[model samples]
Target: MNRPSILWKLYIAAFYVFLFAPLLVVAIFAFNASPFPSPPWKGFTLEWFIGNGSVFGKPGVLMDPIWLTTIGNSFKIALPVALLAVIIGTVNAWVLERAEFRGKTLLAMMMLWPLVIPGVVLGISILAFFSRTANGLEDVLNTDIDSLRPGLPLVILGQLSFILTIATLIIAARLRKFDRSLEEAALDLGASRTRVLRTVTLPFLQPALIGAGLVALLMSFENFNTTLMLVGSDPPLPITMYGQMREGATPAINAVSLMLMLGVGGIASIFALTSKAQQ
Candidate 1:
């Protein structure tokens, strides 16, 4: 038993090392003075953090127009997707958890279909369906259909289709643990359903909704496979970074990655702290 426990501890240590070592390397390389993100330790520098141009040439930070625009685009797509997904998902969870119907099982399965489907396939299907539908509409109207073209709107829609399922699952898990007596008591006190839901149920589900929103935001922000198939000329940060890498990127990419890591880590810490405090 002692030997097995020792071995398990060593295994767990090794697992964490394997998991976090690469991230540490990337975090370190983000400050590498050299142009490239590799090899012999270059003296630490903040040029990459600010922007390559900040030290040597033109003045630009990660907040420069190009990078900033991509960031904005990512947020633009993610924010709406998160909001819509959480709202729809919370409602769906309520129905699935509290209401009974003949086809409830089938409906539940269908709602979760997107979670099981490959993102690439989902993206491609969405693209094809929209393209065919738009083409048909254009043929009927004899006009340009650029307004309904694949871009930010399609990205949001594609992300929502799957992300909402995630939100639904989270909300449903929380809903299942809820005390129905509170709701029943509220109803018995002559409270309207809408009032009961707003005052009691929504508050009860707040944490789950926040968790789902955070998850959806991160998922939308980092999503590549689905966004790739559906994006137009303008790409989000992940796609942009991928392009830069293919075109010979520098430590600047590492710097952006580090910033993202820090931001996400910070957000996660806040969530953790808040959840603990509530508990």
Candidate 2:
């Protein structure tokens, strides 16, 4: 068993090739000089990433104001979603892991609902519920309820609804493995509950919290189905990319994808290093 059978070796090789070949192609095509990313590759250029948008020049992802604005909107939405989701997740993890209450098993099962629901269905439900609630409130109360209308706020809420579930699961998994004796020891020495939590509990949760926040941020950034239902006048980067792809395929999309892959990969690497150091 020291060596894999020929069939197993072939399967393993195919698996890796299948996994990475498309990404490698995308990286290569990002620099393709052709306006489109199809076959018959032209020389090479960075215009898709940094062009000046002259009469003959392509307005790269960086040069396009619309793309930049959409990118900004994505960050605007993702940051808040990540932070708030993490906070909610931490609270959920604490309650679910440390405290017990009536219907705990049912509540725990309910927390997994989001993980199984289809994203588009979830988006539509949230949109419809909020829209009707807003209408009802405006009609009865005779006041504007702008926040309940479709917009970034609603997008954040929709994303948060599902993302917090993921975050909660992650944090709770970590909290489950935590040694309670540390907190008990600190408390036995007359440490306040808040102090013990702040000093001991939170420190132990650093890795899980960081992982959850990163997942939330990335998920929010690339989210499409839910975002599509809830987007307002402003669109996020993924929505903008969809619009562009609908118009025509271009090397610019590849360039943007390559950049995202590099950026996210770098952030993940750093996070891994930091977590290792903390350990």
TM-score of each: 0.91, 0.93
Best by TM-score: 2
What lDDT, from 0 to 1, does candidate 1 have?
Answer: 0.84
lDDT of each: 0.84, 0.88
Per-residue alpha-carbon lDDT of candidate 2 for residues 1-279, written as tens digits (9 for 90 to 100)? 998899999999999999999999999999888878887888888888888666235688899887788888999999999999889999999889989799998999999999888999999999999999999999999998988887899999999989999999988988998999999999999999999989999998988888889888989998999999999988998888899789986788898889889978976886677557545
The TM-score of candidate 2 is 0.93
* Per-residue lDDT of 129 in model 1: 92
Candidate 1 residues lying further than 4 Å off, grouped into runs, are: 5-12, 52-54, 57-63, 273-279
lDDT of 1 by residue, 1-279 (tens): 556787799999999999999999989988778867797887988887676484645323374566778888889988998899899989999899989889999999999899889999999999999888889998999986864578988888888889988999988988998899999999999999999999998998888888888888889999998998899877888889889889987777787788889878876876677455434
Q: What's model 1's TM-score? A: 0.91
C-alpha RMSD values across all candidates: 2.2, 1.9
**Candidate 2 least-lDDT 10 residues:** 270-279
Please report the candidate that would top lDDT against the real structure: 2
Q: List the residue pairs that clash in candidate 1.
A: none
198 Cα displacement, candidate 2 (Å):
1.4
